[model samples]
Target: MARVERDPTGDVCPAFEQPEFQAVRDSMKPNPPGEPRSEEEVLRMLRDSWKAGHDKRVEDWNMQVQRDREERERLEREQEQQDEEQAERPEGEGQKIEEDNGKKTKKVYFDENIAVGDTITDRPASYTLNKLKLIEYIELFYFTPDGCRKAQKESRSTASTETWGITQMEGEVVGLQPISALKLSKFVKPDTELSWEEVMLGRHAMIQEMMKLGDEVWPVKVVEAFNTMYAALDAHPMRRQEHGSEATVKYQAHVRREWYDRQARKQGFNIGVINETLLRSMRDEIIDKKKTESLREVSVQGFQKNLYSFRLPNPYPSILSE
Candidate 1:
């Protein structure tokens, strides 16, 4: 066996000291049966195994990071392709145009035949015609003094009188007289056959045209009522004032203004000063109240008159001359 030696530190070196060698020899000797490893050896083996496990975990983590990077690159390429495809598409295709704010704009289609300045007309008949006729007659009756008093008395029992201010017959008459000449023409002859449907259709068309005219012309319905009332009053004679007296005319004007104010209230309109020139321009068109003519013509005339009369600081003389 190799001789063991003592070092200056006062500890025996295993290679040189006999006692230390003997201890090593004893430790290496085989046991009678199986035995566990020495503490130092077991600790060394555990440290080596832990180092191997640590290296494997680092490799797995690097592999996962690489896979994620590859997936991210693939997604980026796909997104780029989709963007290019969308950009290549034409407008108004299956894909709609979107505003920057992401709202889709609607496509509007216009009818080829519809043009500006076209006129439409209509007529009326039967129960509908009868009802309108009755209202018109009542309006006419309310224009006379006796009619006005009767209307006021009747109004207490009827909603129509209240709505129309027909109770004050003289007042209604004075107010509505300027436009009283307006009338709806007859739809049928004394013994002639006629279709109610045709009459109704005509009436519907007339109403639509009137509505389209809006405030430009007095409502056709009101005009009809005024005419009807006047006719009724004409059938029954009432006390008459001197035809051209200043007082009588002045009173008529005042009543007319009052009636107009009342009408404005009923129609939920602002009571503005009536433009005299515009009223004169519309006079002929409205006065006739022919169902055959388009309300648009009357409206255009009225609008031009009002515009020239009220809005323009100095309208061209030609407009007034026309």
Candidate 2:
């Protein structure tokens, strides 16, 4: 079956219709807090947003890239100087110097990788396992009655889950996320009513439902569950209005620090003990989970971008010759 690419000329921003360009385009767009934009408004906003700050953002990005390059070069020079100094030291002292130099080199490489959003994969097996466990813990905590606190904090209640759908003069922004277990079990049974006391614990309910469906679809369902939950949280009015789009961006330093502090308190670990290395590893796990969630949707923008990379050969060569 041929997949039709959505024409960006309709209502939405052209950049938005193309998922591949979204990461870059997001910063280009101006998003006023709590203001829901309809498709019609998106095109207008896109133009205004680009005209307003696109050049400034490009300049800023170039400056930052230059700074990172300089920093990396500086570290390389320091490592080279240390390497030269090691030769003059005693054998045992020289060995220690070599180890210290190795550590510095590794730090430089790791930091650069993180800055560029590259995946970190050099952790020990135990560390990887612990990272998985932590992610599972955070997700499990979500399905509990305690998870309803997120909704309550935003002033939402069971009485009107429908109102979670935010509307403005422009139109609907994001629709309400169903209160179903894993956002998939409504087909099997009615969606669980949203109430702190009577809410179905998603972890338990998911387990029960998974048994009926068997192992084939379990992975997809789990990823879908996480995605649904995350989308709902991100769409919350408080997150939208106050925090704006960057509130929970996984790569941001402040967001990482916040998550570390929150998780340390919840998991009964000392904040000092959970260092940046471990936090980065855990974030990698989360990134992997998000990747799983996104695999189901094919990006039309990718195909379109490829098509535009080079011109196609003319099918009617005789007409061209004429």
Candidate 3:
């Protein structure tokens, strides 16, 4: 073994005293305690230095790895929160959400049209499943539980069951739905009560909804049914009587005069059924007159603006001809 090297003070070994040293920092060779270090001791000192630095390096690397792991976890949590918000927001009216490949997309919604030949199901009550889709909808001026009950019973084919009954406002109905579900459409908890305005307003809101459901051409009979019911409700003895005959009221007044004519005939009042042929002729004449007047107004406006160089020919000469 090499002899131990001491500090200048002589009582202490340099390795145990003062600051720890690297090969480059070992400048204070002192008198070395009066002997040079042996090859065995020199090699041992070098190995000891290598072990100390190696241990320190391992500890530093472990601390850096722990910090990296924490950063990654924080980023993952933030990303999850962002994804949740995008998945829920409905965006806009008439807009639909579609998702694909962990992403979301929004598109405008349009109603799907149902053709006359297409098959449909109408289940107003348990027994009355109009598989034929023949009967459209019904309306009644009722708010009483028994009013609803008796109206439905006289009209209903069966008893109310757990899964079946009625809950919608019994207003005049044209077509029950254009394929939309109504909270006003189905039976609900018996305890739920509704106000007069709520009942009538719900029906009106649903009628507007049906128009948006791709129903461009409403069936004639359905239109007539709506006209009949709206008139009945409007003229009800309990209606807000102070309402004046405003243009709005006049416009909605039952245009189908046949309703009263038919009712009168059924009651044995002597009046002929308006001939369908003559009715068609009269309707055509009214429509033709309106068109002519509309065209003349447009021409007058165009002339005033100097946009019309001459009068345009009538597009429907055959209809205008005697």
Residue-wise C-alpha lDDT for candidate 2, range 1-322, written one tens digit per residue: 2222332223432454467755555554555786555554655666677655655555556666677799999999999998788767777997786689788453433454445446422211221122233332223223343443443333333335532332121225433433421121111211222221222254343344344444553345544543444444344443334222233333223332354466567642222222445335545666576677666344666676887897888999999999
Query: What TM-score against the true fold does each predicted structure earn?
Result: 0.20, 0.19, 0.20
Query: Where's the lowest-lDDT run of ten residues in candidate 3?
Result: 126-135
In terms of lDDT, the poorest run of 10 residues in model 1 is: 185-194
Q: What is the lDDT of residue 167 in candidate 3?
A: 32
Q: Each candidate: what lDDT?
A: 0.40, 0.43, 0.41
- State candidate 1's TM-score: 0.20
Model 2 residue-pair collision total: 0
Name the runs in model 3 displaced over 4 angstroms: 1-31, 92-322
lDDT of 1 by residue, 223-322 (tens): 4553433233233222132221222222223333456556546643222333334334333333354433557788889999998888545568888788
Candidate 1 off by > 4 Å: 1-33, 92-322
Cand. 3 TM to true fold: 0.20
**Which runs of model 2 end up more than 4 angstroms from their true locations?**
1-48, 96-322
lDDT of 3 by residue, 36-133 (tens): 65544555665676667666555556666677789999999998886776666666521333334446557987667944657432213222223112
Ranking by lDDT: 2, 3, 1
